[model samples]
Target: MAKYSEKASEKVEESMHETKEGKLKSGSGKKVTSKKQAIAIGLSEARKEGAKVPKKKD
Candidate 1:
């Protein structure tokens, strides 16, 4: 199993929450409707924040 930092997990959780509440949006300002997409957004943010997240796959 891959290890994600606490901060990364927290960001993921927050994004998931936003998705559940119908408040998550994509870069184009469209409402996010997929759980996977939400997770991706969270991870991307964590990466920007310098969290212990793995590098994205090509």
Candidate 2:
């Protein structure tokens, strides 16, 4: 199972909302975007805050 800190989870949730509200766009000029990117963004912020977030697998 993928483990994520509370902050990371929150970020992902917000990002998901943005996508749902049509506020975010993909690089391919599409409305559909990867949720992983949102998760990654969240994890990055969590890491900056020293939150306990798991490293992303390459």
Best by TM-score: 1
Query: Which model scores highest in lDDT?
Result: 1
Q: What TM value does model 1 have? A: 0.97
Cα RMSD of all models vs. native, in order, equals 0.5, 3.2
**Which stretch of 10 consecutive residues in model 2 shows the poorest summed lDDT?**
24-33
TM agreement with the true structure for every prediction: 0.97, 0.57
Q: lDDT of each model, Cα atoms only?
A: 0.97, 0.69
What's the true lDDT of residue 38 in model 2?
56
List the candidate 1 regions with Cα displacement exceeding 4 Å.
none
